[model samples]
Target chain A: MSFHDREFKKPDFNRISDVIWEVPTSFKQGMRVPAQVFTTKKLLGEMDAHVFDQITNVATLPGIVRAAMCMPDGHSGYGFPIGGVAAMDIENGGVISPGGIGFDINCGMRLLRTDLTWKDVEPKLKQLVNLLYDRVPAGVGSAAFDDAAGFAKLSHGQFREMISSGAEWCVEKGYGWKEDLAVTEEEGNAEGADESRVSDKAVKRGLGQVGTLGSGNHYLEIQVVKKENIFDEEYAKKLGIFPGQVVVMFHCGSRGFGHQVATDYLQLFLSVMESKYGIKILDRELACAPFTSKEGQDYFAAMKCGINFSFANRQMIAHRIREAFAQIFGKDAEALGMRQIYDVAHNTAKLEEYEVDGKKKKLLIHRKGATRSLGPGNPNIPKAYRDIGQPVIIGGSMETGSYLLVGTKGAEEQTFGSTAHGAGRTMSRTRAIREIVGNTRDMPRDKARAIERRKVEELVINPMIKKGIYVKSVSYSGLAEEAGFAYKDIDEVIDATAKADISKPVVRLIPVGNVKG
Target chain B: MTMSYHFVEDVSLADVAFEASGKDLKELFESAGLAVTNTMVRNLASVHTKVTKTVDVEGSDVENLMFNFLQEFVFLKDAERLLFGKIKIDEISEIACKATLYGEKLDSKRHDLSVDVKAITYHMFRVERTREGWQAFVVLDV
Candidate 1:
């Protein structure tokens, strides 16, 4: 059989509506619902077999509602698959699975707008980039205070406070401005967080590392606007953006705290799930427990801790950036218009009300490698952005362009207020190192990198990695994934969504410089 | 003299019944903290801090003591901008001890910020002994 056929059989691309395609449950056993993948021929060609399997696996989970939907950047991941979205009803025996949340918990991204444009600070770009890089900790176990950020940092008391307070803790400690909290996702914290549920190891890992940026696909980038006026310039100006102006965008998350949360739950669920609920998982990574169960409550509470810690982290980084800017410019960052635009979590599971069967129902939505792209006038949205809707920050690679997009009403009918996070890797990191890295054909890692070796070296040192790495000898049909060249051109993926009218672009950002650990 | 160090991929988890062997509980806790820091960055000598902050941590037992020590690293890294450098064992006891670790504010131009350790995990995590002194595997979650 063709490698694709063995893994995916035939793609049941039955376009159910204008945008949704249904892969019926008959395609795979144990599927509670059908998979609704949002893509076209153009986008489908860019996806791999594993992504198909991931979508299928998600549909089979207990208490899953609607369709096991995937965004445009869908790729093979642990249980839920990156770019995959599924909603489970809490009252209907809905199960909370670690695979749904992934190991990163609330892995997310944020964009900060500054009054000073590239033209205003072009002369001082060198100083700004260097300073930001120096202050923020990066790479593995790269906690802010600890030499080795691990489970030890979280401990008992500190871990409890972080989960309960969310970003308020950081604000109380003066790491960020009080006003900054208004524009953040969930007001920079989740209310349901109960630290009592988190394990001792998870607590120690999180306690002091709340504000640090860890490595492996996590980064801080200093980028420049590639093009403007894709939308109204007046709005862009209001967002503190100008053509050729410099902007800072960062991608990091709850660090080891979240990883431990998902890891601990994955292991716990593995042992208790089948025995307690008679649930059989399609993938070990997809281990789950009923939402009403003790295990589920504990995981949710602990996951909230990770979510809040991430908000605290980004908040801290923002404060430090403001300080650095003030030190150099001799002016307060706020006075200079350096404030947060919006912060969004990409990988997470949340309770949200979306229309189902022409009625609004509350469901737990798990979006891995997908950002919530809520539209305007929703009570959940901050009042300031009510006119324009929530700003969706999509982070591309260091070499490619990141985007600022606004959610549309059309997306509500299509996606559950969600959009792709980035150029989902077609190739695993190991494959990238072996095939794409050090290769002449690969694009420059970034404009500021003196040599490409530094980026490649980091990839080599990346630890705590996971990949199925299917063997051809065992299956004769596993050929599509390798790394870099495997993904479709990211710009094209964005354009496809644009054509579908899912999200309209505001600005495209190309990385001028970046540091990846 | 600078020395070439081998890359210990999974240092936090040992292969065998490799646990730290210290005569006293204080020694065991101290060794646990040391084991964790050494596993993360390349070497302690490469890190230094002119700024000094005192860490006074006490937990009920050996396991909790290790927990407090890990929390200390997190506190110092975020608020003080100090990454752990070296461990100076001043006093050791069943419930508490004093250790002075060396670190400085993060300087990108001057020093490399090696890794953003999210937290340490207890997967195969333990304090153990080596022939030279005391050693333990501290599995770090990167």
Candidate 2:
């Protein structure tokens, strides 16, 4: 039967039972193949139709294999929705677009589990939040601290080390430990990043941004793990998540450097997209080139720079968080038992071997705001985590809880082993401000105006302004876009996901405090 | 047409929008261009015209349509010191726009603004019809 009966934007289809929907090639014009979505009817209703458009766009890209996939938290983005995933045949005509990678670049999230539980932090939530805010710079132009330290405003000749070493570079630079890389995605690095392709401006942005929790979707959150956190806790502990324990979670990426990189390439891609390949684009943001094309190869190389820069950036932030804890507790970082659980990036086009037509072939997979949830026993996963699969850290807003999930056995065939990034934006930022000021009263208007002013200033503004990165998106309901109340209850979303058997949930993280920027 | 933007600080802050209608698209676009420039420099009178350039922008949609057109003007002002004093829209297509903006080279000492508008941003951008005709809203890069 056709999807017409569904009565949705792109009528939802069936892929893997009812949990997954495949938008077959016949569903849309210029669709090279089907676009698969991992969402139920209830969750699908809440998603943005723009996400489907992005998925369809990915499907039409050269060298794409299997299908363009969207996780449960799918939302609109520049070229690819935040929770979109697609793999391409590298040898064929796999293409790469910086927009597909996103502006933050490797803005991934990491979760750290400590021995202390919420019982340890319930009364001290205010103290801990105040302490965290004071220690970690939130909001814009926060890297003044980077300059305070001996680190140069910008680094050189070390960008490559960041690519290969990932978190290790920060560790070597005295920002972190060598062991941290083990808990990071791809050891906190994507291999084959060519730094020479990166522009000097991008490098400048990366220099001070490392170790700084930049403004927007970039936040440090305190979450309490729940028992029925969504799926299971024993599996959560295997992923280093525990019930009632305190965990530090945040998401950011290669900041200005990454944005500039994407910006530079977007402009460059537009010039070459038509002349070199004769490609016509529906959206300027969707500009892309074949992976083998000189322009495409150059962009991939540059994007890897962004990925590596992000790995280093998160590593530095982790180090700073550890420092804050040590300072407050008057104990060594090791004594506090702040150990790296896992860090996973939600963006990038990686060359991986996946089954296409039931045969494994190397494909360039572009995952924007979609975490790579490799199934169990994958060699890429560490020996410790190989049995449980890689840890997927899903960050939700301060109001809605975050989740820790493990890859399911069937995820490989379903989504190339991928999962959602966070609670997809439920409304636009402009709408959020306007909704909060429904009456346009002087009080809320003043606050909104302040936020707007601070945001434009690019200074150490309010943490909420930083939410601009994960700007809320909605259609009919404007109030739902205002705050956490707008997002699907993270707990309920997790339940639907687990019940649907997309990924087995582990730890439920109820946020107590937040530091946005 | 003349335009003015006043950011009054009541409890906090807000960019109060104000515009004057014009006879043509050139005047309309020029007034909007001045609104953006006003955010930076104290006045545009100091930045004289050493050179001028024509910018053509294309977008199938009306929103991008106005955004790209304004951006080129902003780009010339920032990068080339071409402050647009007058504008003349030759043709406006469904997706493309052709315009002639008159301005001269930039002098940092003269057009001394606190935040340098590096480029125009695509964030929270809009363009719509007004009682007079069409209007565009944009945030300048600083």
Candidate 3:
């Protein structure tokens, strides 16, 4: 049934705590387990009805272990709502669905801390932003490296090695510092990546798109660690963040490569979902296969390749950002103290061991639009930051500020070590466009103005400019759509995250410059 | 034959969706292609035939064919940087179709690029024949 026609009662949420809400299994027919949602009472009221429907649909998937969970930033997505998290038991017919990982596989955030302060960069904001906008190829159909010239030089075997090696390959090629690898999630390489499983079309799409910042919420921002916003001063200092300290953050993914890999596998899963697996799904986007099956194994291998591609993609971009800083600040990247704090992937289905029912069990956890927030003493964290737990970068809209947080043990017990990814969208892109530009779908060609080139800036851009944040983008319409008003309030979302004890806020950053695609 | 298509509001806060219909499969495919193109560029009339590419895709069923057909345009846009203003489906069947696409390389100066559609999603994706015509609903990942 369509969403409009479907009948749903206000889900009976059992208040597990002040911030934790649970929809018991009785809420839906096919649900094998309950659904856990983390949000404040007010934020929960703000969610659309479809968010509950989509999360309940996820609860019905085969082999789900505990409950289908959503983070504070949860919103309706295609098959699975964004900010969804669920773990499946491999032995109990657990399945792998591309919808769980999202189209942009390994789409994630990376943060870099620098010794420079906001005062140092504010004077040259325009030049620095323009330089970054130029150096990093962005927007639709933008490619930084020409594939024919670059990949053509490498033999097929060498290209395979690069894909298999992930960020290490980029480091070996001198794209990043060797130390950067340790701070990256999974050490920048996911195991079991077999390039042979990756389709040629996916490979072709990936060739030259490395280091490109893609459109639609993907961006690079120069931010300042605001002293007044720091909630945990000791922890913030331990992370090398301080008042007025300058930092860089960017959000991106595997680009066309990841999209194609997800597309290829979704098609395969759809073709066999009923015949080989005997599984039924509520939505076509939820197509999946048993995790141990050949189809699932193949997708996992190819998905690893996508994950590797993303790691390499961010590594390359990090190198570029460093160069841009060095060029503008008149100091080498090292002397500028531009070191990586951590990198985390929001869209991924990883096989990990977690304790369930006081027994350690292997589960394939799918986190879409959610970040892994592993608590302190987790051996997986880099040795340097193990005492403070993994750093979770929660990016806000260009106009709102972002936050740096630390994982909590409570999250590991409550939600598979996952937390909110960002300030989720509150309005659809069409609605955002309609708000900025008058109706043009029915207008004549001559009457249709280029909203991107319109001289009059929207109300959103004005405030950002007044705040001394320089914004550069390929399209003003795109910029308007991503305005802070279009998304949930970052402060409220983080407040829910902290109150829920999934993650604790360390520092808040105000944007000084933003480069949008 | 009359062909029609219109953008529809999806529940997704980040993506876009559309509904397209035509008298038959050929017209339906063409209308869907146009709808997808319109999401990227501001004005379809402004895009000229500076480049032409043939897209040949095959699938096991009509639904798969629609998925592949729409995905081909996304691939072409990123791989070759071409944005088609016009699409002509020369051949079509339940399993396969061959089409010619006409457009120009994406130019920021000339083309007002809107949403960057990352990929086509199968969320609520449908292709069916009604008494009035063939209709399809598509959700795009932006």
Candidate 4:
């Protein structure tokens, strides 16, 4: 049978609330707990069938606490749904799975607050975007592109140190401001990262890609915060967001290095999982080892390196962005008030303390394509905005706007401090391409695919331009695949999160210019 | 059928998936390798062969071998900044495979590139001997 023909148990969801749905353990034989999904009824219906099967499969894993939860943006991913969040009891036979994280470890969102408004930026927007595009390497084949040589040049030893210390090393190298680390998750440095656990192949792959923004839905956008979009004036002011303020938001991660690290451990775990641990998973991508085992500990150490590498990667890119803005505005970045509001990672497995059954417990929380939404008063949050809560940046498509949100107490009590990441894909890339270029098979190989380019420019790019959003992309075909219509409505997703009380929406920032990978 | 590979639709929500078939294991590996390169480049024929490199990989089984073989190209694209126009299998087996890859270092001005594939994921990844020949299914995380 083909892949789609493979049998998967359909979940019979019981409505726990208007937004919360549960699939009891009886739905799957191996399930250790029920599976839960947080989404509106309409969005839950729109979710792919594979999401139910995948999240239920996650519930079967060892030491899964409470339930295997999927956020509103959940979609069918390899082992867990993309917006999947699961916590494991480490004192038990809890396991660490690379699939639970992702190939691009710590792939995340970063927002920089600038004092300039749209009025100040509109005239120089094109010049600024082109310069930023030139400074930051993006899209496929960027590692080999000669232009990127001017962006970041690090020696082997220095590269190693950067991965070990994350953005701290970058600040020391004068890549960013000292205050920037305070708003970054984990202070932009993950503890227990051992470089020895990373392979030479991984190091080589990651060395040149440090500051580059690799492709596939990764982007850097210049957004404007209109006054009407800001929900809470006090919170917005606290976060340095003002009416008509121009900001820079980018989403990226550790490039090839993280992929290689995850690939290495996934293969290693597959070799020993069934043989050594006697753990049988529903999918090979869910290959895992017990938390306390040598293999698990080694993978965790290596994974931290991936996390740190991404932190440093974003830092360097932020530095470049600051430089570009400084050059364009004819002022220092600090003088332009380019202070970073926050940087939050979505793809990660963090060990955090949460209350369970009125007792404080430390659990290894695996958030793949899910953000950590720490509630107000949580000590983990930065002191400056601790009363407002941890900042959650949810990136939408280039055509639609992105959002600034804050964590809520409801998230801590209900979902283990997790929320949706973005407006998840409702359409495949092939489908998106077909909508633009028609069937590839029907056209001759040497036709130059001029029609494809024209269609993308007309259907995707032109529409965004009509909306006054300037876009610069490396490939028209790549741009077409990321058209806003391919994703679920961002407004609906934010509403779901708000209704669930997991995250409180602060403001919606519309893109004025975008550099898509 | 003369066509060796085709992109599979609807199998993955956000990534690319494809199927390839060949009369033998050598041809199977070649067809799959070409599919990988095709996924990244708008037109496979546009890539002119200039540089040749030999790649060798080993795995526990046929499926793992296919995964490792394809991952080598991804590694090359990132580490060495090479993109392949063509792939020829020098040797193949259930556990190990060796191949010669022909392509030039990436030139942004000359080549029309698409998404950067992160890795070859094991999700729904399969390789099997069919009635006609050998067939393999692969999902690429872009």
Candidate 2 residue spans exceeding 4 A from truth: A1-16, A155-165, A228-233, A439-482, B1-142
For each candidate in the order shown, give its overall lDDT on alpha carbons: 0.64, 0.64, 0.87, 0.90
Tens-place lDDT per residue, model 4, B1-142, is: 3339888876778889999989888888999998888788877777789999999999889998999999998999988888898888899889999899999888666666788889999989999988888989998988
Q: Is model 3 an incorrect, acceptable, medium or high docking prediction?
A: medium
lDDT of 2 by residue, B1-142 (tens): 4333222111101111223233445555556666655444334554455565677888758765665665555445422335655566778665777777666654433443322333344433456556666555454422
**lDDT (10s digit) by residue, model 4, range A260-320:** 9999999999999999999999999899999889999999999999999999989988998
- Against the true structure, candidate 4 reaches a TM-score of 0.98
lDDT of 1 by residue, A294-341 (tens): 989888888888788788888878877787788878999878777788
Q: Supply DockQ values for each candidate.
A: 0.10, 0.08, 0.69, 0.75
Runs with alpha carbons beyond 4 Å of true place in candidate 1: A1-10, A17-19, A145-159, A226-229, A436-487, B1-142
> Chain A TM-scores, all candidates?
0.86, 0.87, 0.96, 0.97
Candidate 2 lDDT over A1-517, as tens digits, reads: 3111123266557656566777888767777778888877778777767677778877787777778888887766655666788887878877787757776678789887677787876766666677676566544334524436666444466654575456767788788877788888878766777777877655654555556665435678876776665466557657666666788887777766666677678778877898888877555667889889999888888887788888888887788788777766678788877888888898777877878787889878788878887878888888888888778888876556687887765676677777777877665533443444332222443454344444333321223335322211111111122256445556555655666555677767776667664
Q: Report the TM-score for the A-chain of model 3.
A: 0.96
The deviation in Å at residue A275 for candidate 2 is 0.9
- For model 3, what is the C-alpha lDDT against the true structure? 0.87
Model 3, position A381, has a per-residue lDDT of 82
